[model samples]
Target: MLFIQHLIRLLAQKRNLTLLTLGVLAIILFFGLRPKTWPNINHAEWSPDTQGLMFHAPGFAYVDDLHTLHDRASDQSFSICLAVSSAKQLPGFRPILMFHNGSDESQLTIAQWETSIIVMNGNDYSYRLKLPRISSGDILLDGKPRYLGITTGDVGTQLFDNGTLIAEKKGLRLDIPTNEKKLRLILGNSPYGNHSWEGTLHYLAIYDKQLAPEEMAASCQLNDGIDRKNPLLLFTFLEGKGTEVQDQSGNDQPLLLPSRPMALKQTFLAPPWPNFTLSKTLLADIIINFLGFIPLGAALYARLRLSEAFSRWYPARATMIISFWISLSIEMAQGWLPNRSSTLLDLVLNTLGAILGVLVIKMSWNTMENMLSHANSATDLAK
Candidate 1:
């Protein structure tokens, strides 16, 4: 009882209260500011004997300044062929390859959701034309390498697994932008560093002309499997050891294997609202975010109320406002950290937690006063 009284009395002092708040803030920063491990290049490896790029976790290699190829491929028929082996099946969409229009807008994306392969064709207006999205069945999770290929012409698009026709859609075509903007090719991860594929990349080749099923199948049989005829882009991953993957198509566009994943430069202040999905992980994140700020709210409210620095209602309001600023600052910082998402949901939850803390301290104020009084009486008696 005496120890509790002493602790409470110290917290009520202005200097001690400031120290306590700073301590709590420090703890929050420590957890939120730590760099993500999966985005590091250490998670990726080059297999010399197998001549493949193995990604133990989410990582990426990118090819930049592809304006010439982007312009030619736009409004034209094309085919893409790649061989990949899934290390483990995950629930969310994992991007294996994406083409961006020199900016955040995506021109094309080939991703894996669970064991299914999904191919989306469009520029920034993809969400409007939802159909023609090719979502294949669970075929890549068998723990063995499989060759996946796609061809898109003016009529429709077709997907092939090991050269076998699996899924095809009409009225869907490769819609690369005709603009002269620079283009980027991201392999193994999304541009935002969110969707990361865990697998081994055997080979990836891009052709200007849509190839027939026989050609696509025949290409998979060869060692490199590149069409050998003027491919727009080809990555064989045969470097064995280097920070760069040679572009065998003679495009002179090399894929750079950076030590860290790419993160958005200016989105730290204003990230788009996170898409909420119901899952255990989501539930846990909500709980952690809400409960984390409770102590700050309670301590600030208590100190403000005890010091009589503000009116009766203002202390609670002030506590909430202060909590909001703190949470927002933290969220902004998280945006720069790889793999750490800066979401409005977390900010709102943390503010609500602060409110809860304020209520808790308000309700327990009388009890704390009584305990302090008893401790004082006991101290007087001993003297």
Candidate 2:
């Protein structure tokens, strides 16, 4: 009863402060909740000059019906060959091509980190199993087009660049998605749609049997020596006018392109666990989050201090609690927005900002009280 009365008294006496607090909160919500992209097909299109699918922005092509790529593999041996060119050197991990088991289980992924090539193969249901991965040095992002190929055979997994063997690891088994599982093939973007590769894909071919050294060399040059019967999936992207890319390998697995470019999968309220990275963007984000909440902290502290019940550390603690709840609410709401990210890091930074605000207000109040006390003492001496 006393707490409610004190809040009412504070609001009634300090209407301007109340308005300021509400106004700040409104501004934060407005900017934080904005969507990233609207539904549009112009983000991706087929280029006649490049003779391939061009991704101008973040978009993807998906293959829903998995027919003969994984189940027909000869003794778990397969080769993936593709000719692609990057727009430029980009930061962070972006998936050029990937295969998953419908849901969240990733089977195989060909991702790019800066100018390096990363091939990850495993059933990543949980973080328990250490997936086998082979990485190469800065070989991508060159001016000319490059043929990237990966062949996993009885010996090991080998990474090929422009028909030449660049990196290889012996005794590593790569698990490709089988036909028994409801698999999904995504090209040019990640399943979650957060990571998208901007590039031009000239051609892609997957063989059931691992290509021999000579065969790999021939296929990298788009020669006619490739085993016609062994190709499980192939895409030339010759249809330079439609939303669907034809599969020339004859398995009838065509890539269906969506008209509206949006996130392929939905994620909600994801915690910031192991995705931590020290980058310029991350540092900038930290600064913004910390500074954004400082005003809220100051306003809360000032409002609470007007109450007689708020004494000593009470106002400061209340300010922090209020700030935490506000941050938590915003983060939770961000999960619903496709562009916004809900992270624990942001919440922590916001709380710290509020604490700093409270400290500043506390120091100012102490200095004012000391000055008033000294003035009263001088007046008493004059009397």
Q: Judged by lDDT, which candidate is best? A: 1
- Model 2 has an lDDT value of 0.75
TM-score of each: 0.87, 0.79
Stretches of model 1 off by over 4 angstroms after superposition: 1-7, 38-42, 102-106, 122-131, 177-179, 225-227, 264-274, 306-309, 370-383
> What's the CA error at residue 370 for candidate 2, in Å?
4.9
**For residues 1-383, what per-residue lDDT tens digits would candidate 1 score against the true structure?**
86777767776689877777788878877776776673355355686557578875557778866644755846788888898888877666677888877444435888777788888854322234344477688878776788888999976899999999999988777665444767778777766665578888888888888888998886654375334667788788877888888888787988887777666332454433233456787788889989999988988887787665698789899999999999899888887765677888888899999999999988787678887788788889999
Give the clash count for each candidate: 0, 0
> What does candidate 2's lDDT look like per residue over 49-126, in tens digits?
877787755567888866775456524888888888888666777778888765444468887778888887642322
Worst 10 residues of 2 by lDDT: 122-131
TM-score result, candidate 2: 0.79
The CA lDDT of each predicted structure is 0.76, 0.75
